[model samples]
Target: MDNNIFGYDHNNTWVHQLTGTSKLLFFILVSIIAMISYDVRFITLVLILSLIILYQSQIKWSQVRLIVKLILIFACLNLITVYIFSPGHGAYLYGTQHIILHLGYFTLTKEQLFYELNLALKYLVTVPISLVFLITTNPSEFSSSLNHIGVSYRLSYAVSLALRYIPDVQRDYQEISMAQQARGYELSKKGKFMTRIKGVSQILIPLILSSLDKIQVISQAMELRRFGKNKKRTWYMARKFSRNDYLTIVLAILIVLLGVWFMKIDGGRFFNPFK
Candidate 1:
């Protein structure tokens, strides 16, 4: 669990030391900004903020490469989809434009390319901000913040446990795969793709069995501790709101307000760059 993907490093940094509520608010505000505007300028502004937060978090790019690459792949797919299917047939709905390229089967329109760029920028804004929140904000901190914001302790704890279980499930799957391999069950196939496919199915039974066993253990532990007996509980990692926290919260609120303003300019939905 020490090297689990979702595990946090408790260091004293501007971003890390900020209250969890501040970070959550920031993430939500940025998400709204990302969702509300498809204009390249607006999306780029949001991405700049996201990049600043990413830098502040002090997380190594290498540590987050896999997730970043996955996001980029999705972004590229989105760009392709929007370019192919953008509404209004790419006739410079908002700006002057001309054809950029032409293929035998498809004509590349200026509006379509700009629309794709907007979609790509939207992913650049949202994904890094989301990754920052996921990597920097510990689950316990998040749960505690949620409790402070009037969530029931039971619900908060359940949410925390659900987050904790993601890495656990990943670890369990790996362990089960190794155990099966040691017992001469082949999961890494050498030849036919179908054989590899069939080999992978061997892992499911053990993984499910181990997950069930883990759930049982957790349930028994909760029962022993009389988990639901108290309507209130104390958190070991509760956050105290400080001046910096207040400032961050204010910034988040401002960002959300700005998003609302932009949404109004967009007529209450995404600002389509093509229009």
Candidate 2:
């Protein structure tokens, strides 16, 4: 198996050794904890726990750079949206005496500021948890684990195929691009924005054609193997859970319980100033 950013690492370790199903269960459990509330403390704790898992996965931080960049962009976009769409309640929450800064006759208030702050914190809690899962979990392991949980092996393999294809698709695109350039296409860095857009548009047709060809080849290969003919199929990457897996699950469940308890006590979502 060629190891890409999303592929499973085969070298024996605590994370690598865990059964695919157990890891999927753990991922879902953590995601539920992360999404169920916008409470600062709970989210913070979940984020911390997720970070610990990421560290334990043993995949280098450099390997997760793409996911990290995406998370940063998402977090920033969330903050911007909250700041702009924040309900105008500035004076009521922030205790700022009504001295409004006129923005061309429209005044901004302190309540909005507080609301934005709350929203920012909510993103801080949610985004990291998501990023941690995306970076730490191996896609092939995730799929095999899902199958172990009684999902159809066909479906699980489809999921695995999608993960496995990302890098292949990227590589294919690069190859196609170079081929296009060789044939008098000016798609290099020197092109204007519109020109580059047009150049990319030209690339898309060939990319789509190549992708369809690849899919056909894969389908034919699967047909030859008589896939889905059996109720269950053995997986190359699947295994049973171990003691470490059980311990990880138990700890995650405990954290979720604590998060639920806190939400019950301290009012759930901190994204609004009125809350």
Candidate 3:
């Protein structure tokens, strides 16, 4: 199935070969660094590296089509909203106002443009790695890794189920959609946009009902098995760290350290070219 959800895509690439724990740690550390700094060179490097990792994972554009569109929409809206709300905030940050355009009350300046450039790069830096992490990490294995690292097995398993259920839910939606199509409702491209939208809503109610029923069944099964009775539990999906895992983790740490160094060198979060 061409998965329309963010779930593990089974493949035998180098990115997929690393243990879930390593990817988890690397994502966390790298996200921290990316979130903290506004250094263009550093952020660009991170963005490039993230894109390289995305390519290495061999993830198809089709599997990510919906999510990529959504993120782009959100990112663009956010950038526009930021500019609308804070037209002069960037010039304020850089302590200089080099006007480039006259947009009535909103005067465009190099500082504001640069700020937005950094912000846009921030999105690029984080989104690819985030997508790769979601698409490549095996949910059950990641849960086991979490518990192995001192997380409660109960919570970890919940996370696993949540991740696992996403694809299941998407699958269910597709099936329901197909059923609807058979009964004279088509969500195809030929239909009007509003008609397609209405058809979608028609499927949502059944999908939600199915999901709730599944959740109840799962909970009852876990209770019958006396899950979470013990404070500690062993993981069947537990993965051992390999040399690649160690190497990847070290690289993540190095990247974080490099971000810190860039912060110190830049003397602040904003790498002001208009200084």
Tens digits of per-residue lDDT for model 1 on 1-275?
Answer: 34545445565678888877778877877787677676566667778888888887888765576677887888788666766565434555545456677653357767766666666677678877787777777889888888888889889888888877877777777787778778776666554687656656877787888889998999899999999897888999886789988898788777777767877787754455544
What does each candidate score in C-alpha RMSD? 3.6, 4.2, 1.3
Pick out the ten consecutive residues of candidate 3 with the lowest summed lDDT. Answer: 1-10
Residue 238 lDDT in candidate 2? 65
Residue 55, candidate 2: alpha-carbon lDDT: 68
Error of 3 at 34 (Å): 0.5
Query: What is the C-alpha lDDT profile of model 2 across 1-275, one tens digit per residue?
Result: 12324433445556666665666677677667766665656666666766666667666655556666777798788766654654454444444534446663345655655555545555555544444444445676767777877888889889888877776776677788788889877788987888878878998998989999999999999999999899987767666668978987787688778868877776553333343
- Which prediction has more favorable TM-score, 1 or 3? 3
Q: C-alpha displacement of 114 in model 3, angstroms?
A: 1.1
| Local distance difference test values of all predictions, in order | 0.74, 0.66, 0.90
- In model 3, the clashing pairs are none
Candidate 2 regions off by >4 Å?
A: 1-13, 58-62, 82-140, 181-191, 269-275
Backbone clashes for every candidate come to 0, 5, 0
Q: How many clashing pairs does model 3 include?
A: 0
In order of appearance, the predictions have TM-scores of 0.79, 0.76, 0.96
The TM-score, computed over Cα atoms with residue i paired to residue i, of candidate 3 is: 0.96
